[model samples]
Target: MYLTIPVLVLLVDLSFEKEYLSWKLLTTKVVFGQAVQLRCHLPKQNCCHNYTRSWRGGPDYTLLTLNEKSSNYTKYIEYLDTESRTSVLTIKSFSESEVDIIYQCSYGFSSYEAILQLTRHRYEFHPTESVPVSLSFNGTHMYAKISLEKVFPKPQCYGNTNEKDITKESLKVISKRNGIFYKSMIDFNYMIDPQHCFGLVTITCTVGTSRITIAEQNTSCRKNGSTFHGKHLAQRDSVASNSHDEESNIVGKVLIVLCFHFFNGL
Candidate 1:
């Protein structure tokens, strides 16, 4: 039953400078109610013939050998092939309590370690909090902007306008929390009908099993409204500063002329 459900398995190769050993860590991305597998193996090398392999994990660093198969919430399996040996650790269900567990596969004196970092893949926007989205029309194009908070492992965001995919520019790590969660921003623009700059705008972002979407009919384009929200708002202050600079220069010139006349009088 556990193998029947859809799961995403990601293989990450951890390369080392030592030619005597070749190993990799495989991570399976899973949701809260799902199971996850952490696999460690020596690939394409018969490096395990001389060294004994074992696994250690959990808060107490409990050592697991070939005979130990089940722990509190974990299951361990080790098998051998013609060219390699593999050790797999499976968590029955993933949750907050199962996080921060360090799993390691030890081969003689060398070992590879991986920690369980829980990632929330299917997050829902709370009703009290508003999704940060803004829309504006600049005569020829309509621009939509959104900011997503607390996304981990980065994300791929796609923007669509009227059922067609548009290009999205992203800014990563505008903010971070707890050294893991990050804030991401995306800007999307599309050429609109000159007569009607309104259309359906949608943005969807995915990270692991987590996906977020925002779709709406862009009705913010109206005549005589602010066409650009992020444009310069201090033009008047800039002109005033320039005028003050000119007046200060004229005063300095007059003071210099007065000092010259005073020294001549003396």
Candidate 2:
């Protein structure tokens, strides 16, 4: 009877650990300008228990959605306590602003959290040349492509100034001056433009080590004699060069140490 009791307790503990450690969200990178579903899965044994899920924006804990007090919140936000143990947060339309927020999933006794961010392509236009430039990343390097409406009198162009790590590969200029508009794409190191002052300049920036990506597009035009000359800029979305693997490793190690101390106390 004593041996059987120990075995039963061991099995129960293992079952809890398996369910507590299950993967909640499956996707690593969420694209900008799309809706996302955040899910939480409890272990089979715990799936029948009541759980609460909530989300907060940034480290400031600005509450975005909560499972409590439905009448106090907007209609777009809904709570589904479908089963006792599992809960899900459905974001109808996910935007770049929401990417940096932290999502927390909790039960009566345990909780888990993750950071959200966005990824996508970007573009920028230089008005002096009346050309549109786009940027993209190829895992290890960055590049750019330039498209033009009319052949400029000059052959060289300059990209908007950005931080150092976000440097672009050699600029590849595509001149289709004969066409009404030209299109091109290129690779470049990740960069964050801090001087984004206008509303229409399309710029995409992702937070470091977080799953947040912000994309903005802007345009400005001036009347030149009888014609209107303008520039259109779109920032492409790129993963922040910064990664959370190191932080995750540190967190995992700390959890292991806490578990050891907990068992020792027991």
Largest TM-score belongs to which candidate?
A: 1
Where does model 1 exceed 4 Å of error?
1-23, 28-36, 42-53, 64-68, 73-84, 92-102, 106-149, 156-158, 163-175, 184-194, 197-199, 206-266
Tens-place lDDT per residue, model 1, 110-162, is: 57776765545432112112643556666676566566654554566666666
* lDDT, model 1, position 106: 67
Model 2, residue 126: C-alpha shift (Å): 19
Off by over 4 Å in 2: 1-23, 26-29, 49-53, 56-59, 68-85, 117-266
With a 3 Å backbone cut-off (N, CA, C), the pairs that clash in candidate 1 are: 121-210
Provide the RMSD of all predictions against the true structure, rounded to 1 decimal: 21.9, 37.6
The positional error of residue 219 in candidate 1, measured at the CA in angstroms, is 9.3
Shift of residue 47 alpha carbon in model 1, Å = 11
Per-residue lDDT over 56-171 for candidate 2, one digit per residue giving the tens place of the 0 to 100 score: 44345455555643322432253445454455555544443455457666554555666753322221122223323444544323344333332212223333333322223333
Worst 10 residues of 1 by lDDT: 8-17
- Per-prediction TM-score, please? 0.41, 0.34
